[model samples]
Target: MNAEPPPPAPQWAVPPEGGWTADDLDTLPTLPPHTELIDGSPVFACPQTVFHSRAVSFFSGHLLSSAPPGLEPVARFTIDIDRSNRPEPDVVVVRANAVESLRQTRFPASNVLLAIEVVSNDSVTRDRETKPVKYARAKIPHYWRVENHDGRAVVYVFELEPATGAYTSTGIFHDRMKVSVPFPVDLDLSAIAPRPRAADPQ
Candidate 1:
């Protein structure tokens, strides 16, 4: 049997008086389609490449497994950066102590320890060049950018420099990745890279 379609997303537009806020988002009966709030305006997220989706799932699964007792990994969850901007990161690692009380649909930047973005063709610049700057400004301690390189998954790790509110390049990793920042972790990059599709025959 065919599955029922999802309910329609709420009409997303700028308010006539002020702008969209986190509180306004909470009042939403149904969320909009891949919408992001930037500077009080709605910016719809681009359609993702299949590889992008795979990497998000792959990293989320591994990050969860390797997460420490008090840290939890959340995927595709919205975070309120301030009164104006709310972004949905591909994955974020947060403290359980704070998250235990989080009933709201979106948490603030203060709750996030690490943010990860899987780059797609449409979102390449946003994920790599743009978000790192924003995440750093919000004081997210760590940031990661995952992309496909020669059919292998590569990760670029960043650490926040609080003094300047900028990220310092920690490492660029491909294949086996070992690190200790938020916590110690050993990751196999190939696990996230999508396999080539099988060929059709006549």
Candidate 2:
């Protein structure tokens, strides 16, 4: 008979109470410039490419520029749910007063009204799978995905349904479409797309 496979090796499990403490979080490898600890596992953030960065900048700038009174735009900061689960959404819109308080530390989930992810080729799976589940678990009210490829943006809007711990699809906006939600303003897709630039000569 073949020998038993070492009792099947103990499976790793996420810690109860607090997933990871600050000290344990500090010991993780620091490379690739940006990584987040999700349930004590290191999840690498997608690297900033030109188009990806542009999409983030465009939408962030638009939100900041057009935000109504009391609303503000936040970018690339960890929104801590607990020690083990801190996700740094690409863009977050929260109350202006809350933004001021979060400057001193990680933004609490209560302050987050909307979370946006600008999907890159490398992060599509994590954004669509891991993150949505995490955000849904956290009860974030709204989530948006801005998908870019060959210079176009495809927007997906999801509204969290508290009863089911999932996001119910609200809308899907393609090129040149507008998205209007409960948030203070409407989002025009054209504003988030790449614009024409003068060609470089040889």
Candidate 3:
């Protein structure tokens, strides 16, 4: 007799009356890690690529070092944009005081000064279109979208316009990146490329 195949994995079901809230994200053990809430729905993150991982690290390190006295950089944390939306940007520059608790998994959007997203094959729509609108409407002042261009990182920066509550592109940077809003930032984008490991000592 042939061996039986394993039972299908369990699935998470949405509630009957309404979609998920930001608070539900904290309690849902069945959901995948790094899941985000958008428009009352759960948005799962696709597997990250090598380029995505390297770029996230690059931005986190540089932003942390470059942040001013009252601001700080945090990586892979969700921002509580509202009760219904809690999108996790790749990196966020937030007010230092917002990190009051070590156990906190999410920060309020009001405390976020800048949000950065490293585009992957699966995140193009959210990173390029959806999240920016939400981030701006929430009054997060700065946003950066990093894309892999010809095996190199290119950054597109945006700043929120207070009156209209929307983001306007500040610059598109390749090879190097420099900006002066929400605290000065200057980065060498080329460093995001992987360097060859030194030959093992003979």
Backbone clash tally for model 2?
A: 0
Q: Which ten residues in a row have the lowest lDDT in candidate 1?
A: 8-17
Model 3, stretches more than 4 Å misplaced? 1-11, 197-202
| Tens digits of per-residue lDDT for model 2, 1-202 | 9876664422233343545543344444433334566776656675587767877787788888877888878787667766678777888887777766533545776777789998877788878998888888778888998897556778888999978979999888776545565454555666665678889997
TM-score (all chains, Cα) for each model:
0.83, 0.77, 0.91
lDDT of 3 by residue, 1-202 (tens): 9999997653445443567889988887678889999988888888888899999999899878878788889999999988889999999999999999999999999999899999998899999999999999899999999999988999999999888889998899999888888877788999998888899998
Better of 1 and 3 by TM-score: 3
Query: What ordering of candidates by lDDT runs from best to worst?
Result: 3, 1, 2
Tens-digit lDDT track of model 1 for 11-125? 5543635788756666654556667776677666677777788889888998899998988898888888888788889899988765755575666789899999887777777
- Best candidate according to TM-score: 3
Clash number by candidate, in order = 0, 0, 0
Off by over 4 Å in 1: 1-11, 28-31, 101-103, 196-202
When summed lDDT is taken over every stretch of 10 residues in candidate 2, the lowest stretch is: 7-16
